[model samples]
Target: MSSAFSLSSGRGRGAARLAAAALVWGLATAGTIAAAGTATADEIPQNQGGATATIGDLKTYGSAVIHENGEDSWVSAGLFEMSVENGGMLQTYGVDLHSPTQRDARYQETSWNGTSLSGNAKAGRIRWILENSYPQVNDLAALAGKAGVTGLTEQDAAAGTQVAIWRYSDGADVDAAAPQAQKLADYLEKNARDLAEPEVSLTLAPAAVSGRPGERLGPVTVHTNAGSVTVTPPTDIAAGGVRVVDQDGRAVTSATNGSRLFFDVPAEGADGSTSLTVQASTTVPVGRAFTSETHSQTQILAGSSESTVSAAASANWAAKGAITALAAQKNCAKGGVDITAANKGDAAFTFELMGDEHTVAAGVSETLTIPLQEDQVYDFTIGGADGGGKRFKGVLDCKTQGGASGIAAQTLSEPSPASVGGSDGGTDLAETGGSGLTPVIAGAAIALVLVGGAVVVLVGRKQTPPQV
Candidate 1:
């Protein structure tokens, strides 16, 4: 992705610097960097400064009784706030509720600040009190008499549900409560189920292309088949010099995180076809460059079966030529020298003008206009198949005309006559000096050696003809 803001010229430099400074200042003030808002279960951040924090969405679970006539439910409330403070201190806070609904639920807020929990002592105390006292003490008067707490019990009675608060001063006291807290947290997590959300699937149409090296192929059309959802175009899709463009011939931004391209889907379902364009870079060679997308059904529920489908499109390059020619005035002053090179051959060939080299295909021509100094000399070289599978090489040397507006043109020709050899009129044999008879003599020598060895073997096995 390109920069969100460009400081290409000096005009925007000051504004860019100010924006960066403001961003840093905002982060420093926030104390913690979080995603935009309160994160969902899957989006919660974890492992902050050696302490882990997890937040689960509130959901109703198992039922219980608080009053004599009214039924109450137990909701395991896990840690809502947990942090590792400076100097290796750990702090945690949580709230548990027992009632059928939030309006009538009895809640207790508890906090602990310490190094570690001791054993199950505090957890046992809490569990025992809730199991033994809560069911029997149906009224506020009985609950206060049992716990020996007066004002808090009266307040809970007025509110119609009990409320308890606890804070541990010593590390050992906090340690005793850890096991029960963990148990409650686990229970809540196990009971909570995710709500279902709409699913979206994406499909990319197949693309095939054949072009010569150094030839730009596209804007090739790409169609997107979206499943029951409105899908947006990818933000960026340039990978390995391959570019994606829109219908207007403008490039579309795309991320390169993986072969799978992700596009935003609107809440309302997208069921129609969307089209884009893909272009292959000129430098791509004779082969296939493929871009793929794998789409999976989005699941809102935990432990749901996931299904994925993948599709790929390829840009194929072949042995062909693409060339161009143009002439223009340079600097609106000097008359430029326009040189054109056309590939009259059947296949792609490499053309070198001066020191620059380009690949040209059959029936294609390339023209270059060079700002010239009078009498300047330039050289050219062309090599590859010409026609009927015959390979050829051509070279040219020309000088610019001595005056402005003067044109000097010449057709390129083979600097040397073709000799009988390979298709390119060039032999693949290594320069070993001796004539082609070298391999023949070597083969004969090897044959004689083999025959002599065979004879020796026969004589050794004869044993004076054995039977005479």
Candidate 2:
């Protein structure tokens, strides 16, 4: 009986040891756990900083060139080229030095979109206008000359050039690009300071925003691991201006004429900002000499596989969420976010904002605000869901909006295959593969298995019968 009991004990011990080893193995190697049914869900990819090839340096001034060499998203691809709109509300006083009818160097000026892309590259129609065209005949004539070299005669030894300035909506321009160059000559002749109220140019472009939604950029990804968010332009509207606020309706961040709203994880104990509004404006000069355009866009994050959204998804109330998503509206309906898993098991979800904690049901959407602090960080968690006999889960999406001229989130096509869980929520257990587990969970499992195996080997040798 003693021998039999020993045998039984040994077998039981071996089984327990083996189970421990397996668990350890699963934890030690996150990759293995991911492959096993112990872990599930897609690990958010790291930022590699790569973009498309056809893109070019979008900025026409300074060292602000769009270098999309290593960005790994669609924003980088579209940002290669920017939409530029130039308008000026200049007020000139104490100066009538140049003649409207005579060719004068004082009024002659030159300007450029700052790019040599050529007419073919532009592909669009060329427009020109004089916002306040009634100073003097000589000045007007000089302006005309600056726009284009229409005619030169023996009577006029020095013929002026007409200038062109691109206008959208309600105005027109003279020279397509160098209107100022030609106009400057005339202004100089008039001896005018031309103290213009800062010429207005709306250069609209989608920015490759980084970090998690509803949070500021940060370096803590463990319990604070949140996914990235993106701001995309609408197809029908352009983003002329951008601003951010907190939940209390206070201003947080403001972008000038040409800027974008980027996303990131905020630090802990961070007070979230509120709504984001994008001012979409087109400088429609007072005259109809030129055609105006309607600028709009749908915010889309390239390389980020999101779910389909319906009209209901448009409902997001979180101001901070709206800022990150760039939604035209400030709220999202219920269950707007969707989740799916590659398998089933332990999974970790990192949410960047407080409101993001709510799980995305079938068709609901939620929105929240992060206090306006560009330098703060925020993080949240999503609970795990039962694979329901399938695999995968988590908040696949969060929809929000910025005002007019702001970025927007992409809509999902259909219901996601997985369920979204929050860290604060109760876990729904359903065994499958480890693909759903967070990276940390998988790594821990593997380490445990390796340790167990070593212990089993050591104990087994000591129990072996004496050879001599």
Candidate 3:
């Protein structure tokens, strides 16, 4: 998403710029895990006492500009461009300014491009122009006194060309004074023919955010930090989706483009502070099982710093099981058999019993007394539709009361087939059976057969007695 904020000129501009620079540096440094080192200064070159040094008296005028160029995922280069008007001045005196240090400790030198020098400098480093005129120790001392600056010292007072140096343990001090120093440098460079400083412009790198991965099957939230800015909806936030609100719970206006969310916060508060709120949201498909995911990325806010935040969301769906019971009444006062069907799942179902169709809504139980002949079996079909448009079909074998009858209930523990007219394809059934007389009659028949076999064996033995 594209978001822009206005950086009001004046005092706020400097603070906003500095904050932005800090933000860029923080983002760049966050990826590098190394031992911190103390700042040390390199020895300055000394002028050897010799014959009157012949300093080139060439007049010079030029402009220096700085640009920000991103080089990789974790690094960006700040480039400086210098353009001089006179060719002779280029050979006489080169520009001297402190620049940012690169990831590599070696200082990068500017290459000549048709009388113009341009090269990459360290990101977020402040560069200051030093005096390059000869025999100006008295003038340098006076200027330092006027400016109330204490770091200035003349490096070579007797050389034909004067060189002044400012000893700094680190770039932090220079950065603190960069805004005011820039104004002075701009003015002097514009008017002074013998001295010049480059005009510097900084572009901060975009905030690198760690985005959630996998499929976020529902509403998901993503967050990151932008220096002093605090991100809400911490990592692994599951509910309420993603949203940005002020202290009063007032929603901040925002727009989302694809996976990126863009919003603006005031560059500075009424008290000259920086504060803003932002929220982002996206929808993902949920599956049958629970799915957990994380989102990470880098975001760049206009006129602000880059921040990286990661959030997690878990997508879950309920696994439903139908609670069903089949009740049968045999030899009722007036009916063949009473059948009842109950549904406890969150879905309505349709059932067919003894050629009668019935509808059973979710969490409801329906009972119907149907007349059927004794010892006769009938097809009792039940079907229903779930929330996902899937169909379920079940069948029960219903028989009227044969001998003795009472109420009986059967519980179903499995899901029905997902098609109409589909049999259970199993022998398990819930039904009332005939009386106990069937077993007794079968026993009597077995006894009669045994007696007949004994009588036949005795007659055969009597007929064969003479042969023995």
In candidate 2, what are the lDDT values of residues 1-468, reduced to their tens digit?
A: 000000111122111221222222110011111111112322221111111111112111100001122211111001111122221221111000000001010110001111111111221211112232222223545544643433322111111111111111101121111233334324423332222221211221221121222443211111101122222322211111222322343333333332333323223323222222232222211111110000011111111111111000010111222112111111112212222211111232223222223222222233333221111111112212221111111111111111111111111111111111011111111100001111112112211111211110000001121111
TM-score of each: 0.15, 0.18, 0.16
Task: Order the candidates by TM-score, highest first.
Answer: 2, 3, 1
lDDT of candidates 1 onward, in order: 0.21, 0.18, 0.21
Task: Please list the residue runs of candidate 2 whose C-alpha ends up more than 4 Å from where it truly belongs after superposition.
Answer: 1-119, 122-138, 143-214, 217-275, 278-468
lDDT of 1: 0.21
Badly placed stretches (over 4 Å) of model 3 are: 1-323, 378-468
lDDT digits (tens) for residues 1-468 of candidate 1: 001221121112111211222222110001111011112111111000011112121121111111111211111221111111111111112111110011111111111110011121242233222322222234645554443444423213211111111111011101111232223322322332322211212223222222333334333333222222122332333222333444443445531212232222222321111222221111111010010000000001111112221222333232323322211111112223333444433554454333444555665656555443211222211222221111111111011011111111100011111000001111111110001111111112111111111110010010111110
Superior by TM-score: candidate 1 or candidate 2:
2
lDDT tens digits by residue: candidate 3, 1-468 = 111222222121111211223222110000110111112211111111001111111122111112112110000111111111111101112221211111111111111110112121221111222232212224755544444444433321111110111111111111111232333333323333321222111110111111111111222222222112223432222222333333334443432222232222222211100112222221110000000000000000001111121222211111233333333333224323444555444555454433344666766767666553222222222322211111111111111111121111111111111100101111122111111111111112211111111110000000010110
> What's the lDDT for residue 75 in model 3?
9
Error of 2 at 146 (Å): 6.7
